[model samples]
Target: KIKEEINKRIKEKIKGILPGLLEEEIEKITSAKEEELKKGVERIIEDYQPLKEENKIITKLFRLLGDKTAYAAEKKPVEKTKIEIEIEWIELFNPYEVPCEVEGWQIKTSLGTRALGGIISSDSYRFIFNMVIRMPGKSIGKEILGDNGDTVILTNKRRNIVDKVSYRGYGLPWSAWEKNDPRSREFASILPGGSPGFRNWFWMPEVGEAKNKNDYSSFYVKDKPFANTGEIVFIHSGEWRTIRLEQGGEWQILDKITVADPPEKPVQGRININTASKQVLEALPGIDSALSQAIINYGNSKKRPFNEIGEILQILLLARLGSNGKDDDKDGYTDEEDEREAIFRGLSNLITTRSNCFTVISRGEVVKNDEIVAERKIKAVIDRGSSPIKIKYYRELSED
Candidate 1:
């Protein structure tokens, strides 16, 4: 019985792991002689039963094994992690065609870094393409701006931005403004700000007021009232500016500019099982392109949604693969289908009840060589359930 149980469990496991493989293939792999297979299965059950008795300990042991194995194997060679490709949004003057050049733009982040350089655009948003940078072998001592002005490196951390720096007096270096102008100096010294100007401008009104009139700046611009002040400022200007109310008064600067990132396109939604393309269906879990196509074909022929999962099993079974009665080859039922059908049948059988009749004998005396028996026994069987067996005159009768 133990062996039988193990064999059953092994069969179930094989069916689950390789649903596409035929039962014969599974049998070949397990290669257990009938009796040996049964013994092996029984042993597996015996081993598991004790563990099940101590469920908590067994579960923890398994989890620890998995974690430790993974940690220890971390040094082994692995496939490269997928890199997220950087997408560049270029500015176009025609709103359709790519731009020839973009000017007077600077990229900045919410962080304090400012003056991250951006490129020129005549058509769309101006952006650099295929930009790549490697990390330093050792940590850099302090934070410094990269050559493009769009990157800020601090120790091992680096940030990228999209915006062009606005030079004062055309050819003047960005560092020159740092000393002469407080706002320009602040913007250049800190991390890049959001589009138009440094992010600090939104918090510090004085900084917004200090930028050069012609230089572009970016700040957090909102139509709503400032958090500090319950009142809203509705000032409109052709150039970008950050407005904020300080303890002294409202501060607005003409040099402040706005910087905006390129808009992203919407993504396509999940594929419909009924009408999905082969590629779309193939992307689904546990489904291949061929299976997806087969599904479509089956659905088209039936002209309706499958009533139950079992129907698919039936279809696959009817389509079996090989010349042998048991061996289903290509274009026929897959091993997966058979396993699924078996599981479905098992579930269905569990709910069914048997009803039948039986008989029982009561009060019988045993005799040897025509001599009357000394002991008497009583037994009775009733038509209660499915099995029809003759009851011996020894056990108590059951009422039905």
Candidate 2:
């Protein structure tokens, strides 16, 4: 019986070992199949990589070509949305003997309705600003006068009436019209009418039915007061058409329109004396043609050629005394003396002499200073003359 039990135990062990051996063989076969499948997938991907790269390159090339073609297509040039006009005027003031260049002056437009008048009289045309208008493109039509005596009209290639509206000159302090004025109200009712909009007229792409009628009474001016100074230009059909006085006066169209460029500003290190023409002299403060000529004459008479601009003060004093300093006691100065001194004092800080030298007085000391304050050295001098003189010596220093 014992021998039979041992044989039975050995048979049970053999059965368990056979099952484990079969499981190991199955696992080996599964692993080999998985490796073969991975290799096959990698081979497929490697074979198509060049074709994918080629496709990407072709797509980029086509995109670039399409961009170039679109860029070359023709298109109409866009019209300018706004127009610019430069105005020039000769302003005059009272005491006609004073000189035209010395008068208060400015440049303006004609379409805007405002009046900048001081004293209204036939003789005291206290200020007359002779104006000239400048435009960029071709002129279509220009009207010197309009139904409203002061209004002027200008047009572009399309011949659209630029100044179809009218403005009243409200004299003196209240020199501009009210927004509720019949003309202003009517203009505001129209498509485009009010302050700056009035200058643009009703000629905008967004404007539809309102473009037909020429009347602009439905439009209203802005309630704001007129600007003390500025320009008003009329833009229509993508072109600059007309200019009006937006501030300081009635809309007086300037007929002397020209195409020349504006003058260049004066250079530094140079002195522009009042001796130049009306245009040149106007640049100086309180200088008019008469006064400018006077200044020129005084400059010429000085044999020393103005070592410094302060010499002008002395010259003006001399000129006021009829070219003699003898009247020093008449209070003892002439009207010319007072006028010259006043003018020099007004411009003492701004004006420079051709010699590029200036004088400065600190208390009782005469100090000579140079152009470059950074390297300036202080020195003192004394003079026993009636007028205490202070001199500052300076030269144009190198900018290292």
TM-score of each: 0.16, 0.21
Measured on C-alpha atoms, candidate 1 has an lDDT of 0.31
In candidate 1, position 114 carries an lDDT of: 21
**Which digits, one per residue and each the tens of the lDDT, describe model 2 over residues 1-400?**
1112222322232222223334454344334334433443343223223223323322111121111010111112312111111111112223223323311222224634223323323213221211111122322123232223243332323444323334444332221222221112222222211122121122111111122356332222345532211112221322222222222212232212211233132223334353234455544444555666666677677644545444454443323423444432232233322222333323333344432234433332234573433343333343222134433343333334
On TM-score, the leading prediction is 2
Model 1, position 43, has a per-residue lDDT of 36
Off by over 4 Å in 2: 1-271, 274-294, 316-340, 355-400
For 1-400, candidate 1 gives per-residue lDDT tens digits of 3334333444444444335557886676445335544443343333232222323121111121111110011112321111111111111112222233223333332223323233334223322211111111221122223333332221111333222333223222332112111112233322221222111222222212213565433333554332211112224333543232221223222112211122132112323344555665544433444555776788789888654332443344222321225422122233322222222222221111122333555555578999975555456555432234433334654333
TM-score of predicted structure 1: 0.16
Q: Let me know the TM-score candidate 2 reaches against the reference structure.
A: 0.21
Stretches of model 1 off by over 4 angstroms after superposition = 1-272, 307-310, 317-400
Give each model's clash number.
Answer: 53, 38
